[model samples]
Target chain A: MNEKKSSAGLKLCISDLSMSFGGVQALEGVSFEVEPGTIHAIIGPNGAGKTTLINCISGQFIPEGTMHFGERELTHVRAHNRIQMGIARTFQHVNVYSELSVLDNIMIGGHHRLKSNWIRQCLYWGPYGCSREEQMLQAEALELLERLEMRHLADSPAGELSYGQQKRLEVGRALLAHPKLLLLDEPMAGMAKQEKKQLSDWILDINREMNITIVMIEHDMTVVQTLSDQVVVLDFGRKIAEGPPQEVVKDKRVRKAYLGED
Target chain B: MEPNLTDKDAGTAAARPLLETRLERYGAVGLILALAVGSMLISSYHLSLLTTITIFAFSAMGLNLLSGNAGLISIAHAAFMGLGAFTAAWFAIDLGIPILIAIILAGIVSAGVGLLFGIPSLRLSGLYLILATFAAQIILYWFFEQALWLTKSPDGRFVGIPEVMGFEFGDPWHYYLLVLVFTIAGAVVYLNILRSGLGRSLEVIKERPIVSQMMGVNLQRTKLIAFTIGHFYAGVAGALYGWHLQFVATEAFDLMGSIELLVMIIIGGLGSLAGAVLGATFIVVVPELLDMAGRRLVDDMGLMAPIRMFIYGLLVVIFLIYEPHGLARTWRKLVRYFNKKLFKNKNEH
Candidate 1:
């Protein structure tokens, strides 16, 4: 079945983004560019401000930075508006609406795409359009569930899912937004080895099939080396290494940051 | 590779709506019919009780949506009702606006005022929303009491007997039917809204505002809309209430009224329209039944004031502890049990 997704990814450019909490500088003049339709992984140790950088790109932070998605400047765009511009993200922790059905939780990601006059929609008049819009959305969400091979679990509450499955649900929810740029904050964190491999494959599928640019923050070096086309390593709130995954792993500063000074 | 589920559970899954669609399809009609039957079969003596249940349910359904989906418990809901009743009464009585138009206008005006109070919901929720709306109730009641020109009398205000075309809804049965139509309309509208995109947003907003916002749902706007729609229902219900009693009194729409609506929604269930109706029925009918029993036992008109409050508090505790999802979840469980039991009995037969 043909999937209706956002037209291929946009160039995500982040420049001079510096954010600090009081004296605790989480990200300082951190800059990176993610080419369209590629997986760009950011690797860092504990408190390296990896998540902070992702948050900034996803409009969760207003750091001293200029962000450009395609031609649109997102320096001042709010979180919700960033999603409107096709920037969707998953949290570091799995954040599914536990009380909702699996399908219902995914459908929440598509609500902003609902385009109908608010007044007419409220009345539920057939010709007024929102009812029809929702029917189409339900079908779309169901199709997405089917593609994720989670069609049978559609009726079950999200809380009942295993931890790894919850992570996948969070990713599925993000995908439903038809994001041009997907920011995954620690997508592999806290997953079993097999689950990590499975999620890495799913991330690859999301990138290839949807033609979406992915900015993932991960600590799994093996998974990152295999999946990502490019890599940026951060240590102490600063970019220490940038190149192909294999080269970045061998960089002097990156090795020193991970293994301590030689 | 994924979690395993039994086939029996799959059957239940097939019966479920993604969210609120099934209720609109079957439950909404079933509720309206049951009330219609109640109107016919019940004694004219209890006709007023039936009418009051539907009227309260109209607004209770609104609170049901706000509290159930948005996770907002509004203590000022009754105050908004008071606002609508007064606005509709003022338009109809003072300015001589068409009564039906005035009622609709009253709903809009109440929504506007509710939006003002709902601003607090943007920064707060749960117990905090209750506190914020509590202040709203007190403030609105103060306005209702002090605005002598609106009521035309310092004591209370009276509205004319409602007339449409040549027919007058002066009789109890006629008034019941009129209120019934409005309540049914409210139910249908509530169902439709729930089955749509706005309903989806509220569901996510309730669970996690951060997730909803990340998905491009304007969190502030959605919460405000919940407040708006909830108050719109309160206003319409208040207008119908005004005509039902032929009076707009501050005492009727006080903290007690808001508490009563909250109790109805909680006891019935939060998210479902069916729960809202059942809750309204339980809250209204149980008390009146007790009142009747008390009257026969004591030979007194003032049978319950303090006693009723104690009962509501107790019932809320019982429901919250035993069936936290409220009566809707219980209703679903019963339906599922019967479906299996009846099928087994048929196979045996």
Candidate 2:
């Protein structure tokens, strides 16, 4: 497959990665490379194991083969520690702190960045006088909210937001982690066209402005075609096609997988 | 000079009064006023009862953090309290340490023990974690009963009168004041922790462990901290219980005591400071009130205990089935209803 390029800028590598649940093989010998500072899209029909692939990369699923981010091995890293190693992710379904304010939801995303000890937090003071670290976190979280045009909803409970807003908030939350590699699973699913356009714009802006590598699973062909630098198409837990979106979409096998024809 | 306020600023300004109700602003003042009035009106016997309620409230608040906020159910809460009581007694009597230091040391020791028991929770949750805590309750109660070095007395360990500086807190009145102060301090600390990052992390972890992990919250560490902090509060309550009664016994902190503390949090509201206090008062005073009524209705006072237990069991069942959120939620609903009615009438006028 074009010599499987492995230059210095390769941000993520998955080799011979296989996962199974009971007797069902969700993924089998999947291999891919995501370069730094680019948007890579994985598209597939139902049960193509797109979500499972992201889960394996995010450490929720234990796959058979090795996976690495940069040079660091991520195969055995705990899910929480993966975030510390600059890996962050959003779910297909909206998962947020429903009871907490929108601001607090994003501040929790910046948890690893804040260095104040638990004892200091208990005392309502930190190394930088009293509550300075907390204030800094608040400022950072507010900046993210402003960027997302959600500063007006800061004090509102996260659950009270509209579904599209919740989806945007989820992205803002993951961004607050300052991840080098962000995995987004169906981020634009269930959104109207206008909402999808706005979200696509935000995603592109995030990739360009922050120089963060993004690996996303999307069912929207238009989104994949417009945004992806590279596209990997999966069918039945196997890579059916891999290339730039324009070339991959025109492939006979990808069409067969999507249309169920020989 | 006049300020230029934007639409967003005006929106937030309009929302402020709607968000911050009278109860939200003056709730603390109301609590203090109630406590002061209660102290003045009650007899010395009733004063002791008030102190007992305050002590239970402290432990209930602690348990609320674990079971309510962190979503880790524990049935060994009183065992931690027993450990604290024994530790305080040993330090105060054997080491001749001051009572205040002894209490703090007791809390520390109980927190350590709590951390040990909390290890199982790293891998277990819900009913499985509750079972682990049940094991802790049984084992710790057995240890307190068998260990003569710690218990010291076959009947029970008798703690000396607690003293700070030159003031002896032997009198019920003085001791009531001491308990009140500690109870208020405990409530303040509980509220502070709820707003802190650590507390928020626990809530996230409890709500969605996988999501919390993605957000960079260490699930195991946060769970362990919640368990330890809960036990620390329990220890302080136990030490206070020992000082109030001048006694500590294995029988006092048995399985029943643990269940009672759990019941207190459940009935009051799970995850709320006010709920803890309300539940404590209900659990402590309800039986006494029932006994008083039984005295007038029937000549047999012996039947009162069983009747109270039956009623208590019924109340718990009713709450669990009908109002799982507990009394705090019910209170909030009532306040909201009244506020709506009052505001509706005003708007019409």
Clashes of 2: 0
Model 2 spans > 4 angstroms off: A1-10, A126-130, B1-26, B33-41, B331-349
The residue-by-residue lDDT of candidate 2 on B63-114, one tens digit each, is: 9998888999999999899999999999888888888899989998999999
Candidate 1 per-residue lDDT over residues B117-217, each given as its tens digit: 88866899778878888899999988888888876665669887987666788777888888888887787777777767777788888888876777888
- lDDT minimum window of 10 residues, candidate 2 chain B: B1-10
**Model 1, residue A74: what's the lDDT?**
90
lDDT of 1 by residue, A44-155 (tens): 8989999889888887778887888999999798788887788899999888989888988888777667776556666665576465556566667777788877898987
Candidate 2 residue-wise lDDT at A38: 81
- Against the reference, the lDDT scores of all candidates come to 0.81, 0.83
Clashes of each: 0, 0
Under CAPRI classification, how is model 2 graded? acceptable
